[model samples]
Target chain A: MVPAADNQTRSENETKWQLGMLLSRPFFSIGRAVIRWINILGAATVFLFLALVKVFRSKQLSKIVQQLYYIGARSTTIIMLVSVFTGMVLGLQSYHALVKFGAQGAVGTLVALSLIRELGPVLTAIMITARAGSAITAEIGIQRISEQIDALHTMRIDPLRHIISPRVTAAIISFPILTTVFDLIGMIGGYISGVMLLGLNSGVYFHSIQANVEMKDISDGLIKAIVFAVIVATVCCYQGYFAHMRRDSHGAQAVGLATTSAVVISCVLILVSDYVVTSLLI
Target chain B: MNTPLIKFKDVTKSFGDRTVLERVNLEIYEGEVTTIIGLSGAGKSVLLKLIIGLLKPDEGTILLRGKPVSKMKKKEINAAFAQMSYMFQGNALFDSLTVYENIALPLLETTNLKKSEIDRRVMARIEQTELTDAVKKFPSELSGGMQKRAALARALITDPKIVLFDEPTTGQDPVRKNAILSMIAQYHRKFGFTAILVSHEIPDVYFISNRVLALYERTIVFQGTPEELEDFDHPFKDEVIHSLEALQKELTGLYSKRQFKVLNHAQMRRRAFGDTYCIAVFTLEDINSIIRYLGHDAVQEAIRRMGLYIDKHFGVIGGFSTRRNTNEIVTVLPYSDITEAENILKYFVKDFQGLEINDIWTGVRRRVAMAGPVEFTILAGIAQGQPIAEIDSVIDSAKSHQKEIWTATMRRRGEKI
Candidate 1:
């Protein structure tokens, strides 16, 4: 019963609407993802700020020390183990490349610089994220679901002060120290591969590291470590602390998901921040 | 009238699209035990959280002592919080901390008390909670009951004027559940603190509660004294309360009324045309007086003990029992005549009389001292019925023939019965 002109107009309008929806869907998805990430980042920043404000609460020293033992001291063995293998591989590869130009002596310089400037902080952070960071997330997630955090609130105790601040403080103290250990142990691992196994001059290896390494490089690496520590601690604690808010899961499953997300996000943030810090400092 | 201690005025709370509580209005008086009863997940805990400012309402106001909590300054909120304590549904004892450390944490964090004072208070609480042996153990290392006690000890350590208990006896056995309720009642009387309890321990909680708030369908459906609640007619009463009673029957190892009918039907199906059965109704006489002189807890214990004795004697003879009401147990002995039932009833009476039911009163006596000796009697009535007979009529006949078969005069601990 419709007129030709009216039918034509309706068809054209439908086509336009369909085309518009088709074109805007991707933008809509991208916008949604962007907004979600922004919300997460904003929430994490607030959580970190609140925790930092309560870092100096009464009797916080003991809690921080305990976290240091867990995040820094307990992780030392795994850090050392991974660092040795990584340094040995780096030594073997660099030796092979440098010996092509009769420049194998520079292997020491390359190993020391690479580990001190980049590998030490990045590898140490990733390893700790797998070890201590996941544990923190799971622990806090369990506390969240089990109402321990609510219990703390009812007791008039700030959970951020009691739980998160100590871990964050410990991370700030521990990361740089652990990174320094990684550098030292990794360089020794390079020595074992370059000098002891490949017959490079031991004196040349030590002298090259001594002569080429600068305080700026060490400080830059330490700066990266500190940044990585903050990112990892904040992301992990935020994930666990708000696990109960996750819509996709509940209870123990939520805890597990939070732990996984914490580790993944922490490692991503660590590497991404490392690059940014390195670019600024360089 | 005195002003309410905490009042919720047209409060509404929602999570995402789901509205948990809608325009909920309730008042809690000071120095009285108020219990919030409802179906699970009906926002009872949400109401408690609103009172304590753990969760803020999406609309309206929560007032503490006539002052709005949301409008209170930080110092005012802190002062208000200092007078309150909450025991969570799940005993949220910190797993990493030892019992002693857990109990001592609040004092250490909130107060500048001397170490000796903290130690004394912590040790006293631990001893009172009977956690002295488990003081060094972590929460994970303790039994479920022990963890609950530990959590209770922690909640009470601050000696707050207002205590919020969220299903405090959820995972306990009947005996332990009664003990915990008694403990709360005793403490409430001793400290004169306002106790706000969220519980599913029906009838038991009603005894200790001065006011009962029934949360149903996302609002406070009824709020009044326990006696008033009993008389208040609402779907919540038939749905939540009756369902809980049914659940209690299962928990207490007795059949519910419906279950008893099904069982009786099954018994009838197995019976021959000429075969007869006996129905006996055992009523704990003077229950109202027992509740008056002794207490609800004592009457409950007596009923439970009677049910157990009935089960023990009749269960082996292919008989089953159901709690007919608050003070009566109905037993169906299949394929047994009146004489046979009478003989079994005599043995039951003898065994029950010798059962030393006074042990159940020991804990109650410590709290409530009696002026004179109170005697408790159980009256039994038996009636013969054919398989085709109406169960109601037969039960009525048994009730009409009721006579005292056993009596016990509650005496002093060392006095002869």
Candidate 2:
């Protein structure tokens, strides 16, 4: 009341703050809902798998096993080859550095520990995500656009259980197994480079690797693999699933948007979950 | 009668509140050719998607087989998918797969059939679409018409009870469009499946579609037979009838259409040359280039061969013609208008050797006669009365301005001026 301009300014400020709250609440609510949906789907997929394992036999088991085979067995050769080269490169680099300090024997410790506890699991998770994520995303997206997903819901088939569950569980099973295989091949590579190629005694090489790394390190690698698996599979499935769910009249843009979001969300979640898993465990 | 296959009740679909289908109530029955006609974006495709479960109504329910789609379970929905197959707007054949593989996917994945039987059925479908040659070809490798046929083959692979065609004639040449439509009609006849097609193409009314549904403004504006829509006595009809009537008229008088077109072309050509007088006539009668069942490029070569000597003398240019009606076209030299006489006549050719004329379809052949100042330029001799033939007779007979001989059509005086 002291001045007309001052009163208008105060009212404008109040309106802006109120509008911000209005926008913020809905935005945060949707984001939180999406995250909760993803978690529920993840846990639900695990439960469904357990339930299916009890009831399914013979043909069903073979089908699910065949799916897992397609996901994992097909991936093993590339995973092993890449891991061996990664370890060999690490051994070579670390050997040169350690020898400068007259600690060439520590090459085993560096390669084994680094590959197992970090590169092996993370790299494997990334590769499989790229390979399988696009396939799942595109399939789910097309399904959404085509009304197959709605048809499932109408028929009392839970799309999450039938489609998402199988994919996510398959990814979860595949990644850790693939990572373990990577670790073994990576250890062999470290041995070849350190003991045979770099002239460290085979005995000292094994001893240093054993002494420096513990069960905790292997467990850390396994844990990282599990987390990365869940993140990639869940985020990708969620993105694909939600992107496909939009009932926009313009179907092409929606399908394209779904594909892009699936890849981006899977990649970001992998990175974010990587940091969280590392910080909590370390 | 049996319960309707699909029922939409007050189903309002919107994209972010911009409602496309507003409170639309419709019922689709079994084994009927329901052709939906409207302007593009009248939400015809959206309505098809809604009925097929591709989209959900924001306001109401879609009932299929007497059950609300919203309440149905997933297995039931998958079962429904078996009963219906959708041919998308672009004939969404999987470009990555061969025609055989694309058709085989749904059969192999969804049905409990042996691979051998699936192959047999897929082959049978390819043969039925007259696409036996395209079985191993990827979708992108095929021509536009062939791609649509392949998609139709895939749609039929399931032997679905209901087939949805989204714009079956959107991009095909007229001859190819008819070829696909005939195949669709054949499938409808042989299989007795419900054929609901969403299209904006003008209907071939004489063919007698069982029902025509038009989406206008935001609701089902007209629902009737093709004959009923053309009656012009209907109540509550959206006002696009005059244009529709004109299209119907053009479709019937395709002969006159081609002749008038050539006359128009001659007019434009004469204008282009400023004062250089030349008569020309052509039919938008798209021949070899488009009428592939008429024998590929062989028909075009035959037409060219008839005028090979004349083309050299006239600096003649001819290719595909602009189609107001997509039947046939003959160019007057530098054509598209109908002002010139000599240019039109000299350039006209009605009956080329080897260019077979379908009496009713290729229209009555005609010749155009135009007298030019430079040594009686006997451009083309077309037979009189028939669209292209009359113009050819005009070229042969009209030797001199004094021997104007026979002015066949009074329209030729109109054609002359």
Looking at model 1, residue A152 earns an lDDT score of 93
TM-score of 2: 0.64
Q: Which ten residues in a row have the lowest lDDT in candidate 2 chain A?
A: A51-60
Give the per-residue lDDT digits (tens) of candidate 2, residues B1-417.
679788888899998759899988777788888887766778998988787776778998888878888899988976776688788777766555688887776675566788799989988777666676777888778988777777777778877899888888778654455556655765687789998998644544224257888777788877767657655354424354445535543433222333334454465444533333233333323232222232222222223232332333334443222222122223333332234444344333333212322221122122111122111111222222222334444433322222221112212211221
Model 2 off-target regions past 4 Å?
A1-106, A127-170, A188-199, A210-220, A240-268, A275-282, B1-3, B65-81, B205-208, B233-417
lDDT of 1: 0.87
Give TM-scores for every candidate, taking all chains together and pairing residue i with residue i. 0.81, 0.64
Q: How far is candidate 2 from the true structure (C-alpha RMSD, Å)?
A: 12.4
Leading candidate by TM-score: 1
What DockQ would you assign to candidate 2? 0.11
lDDT of candidate model 2 versus the reference: 0.63
lDDT of 1 by residue, B1-417 (tens): 689999999999999999999999999999999999999999988988888879999998999999998899999999999899999888899998999999999999989999999999999888666677899999999988789899999999999999999999998877567657766887787788999999997766776899999999999999999769766888988999878867777667777665677789999998999899999999888665655455444455656666876877799999998876667888999979989888988887776666544543454464332334677777999998999999989999999999988666765431336
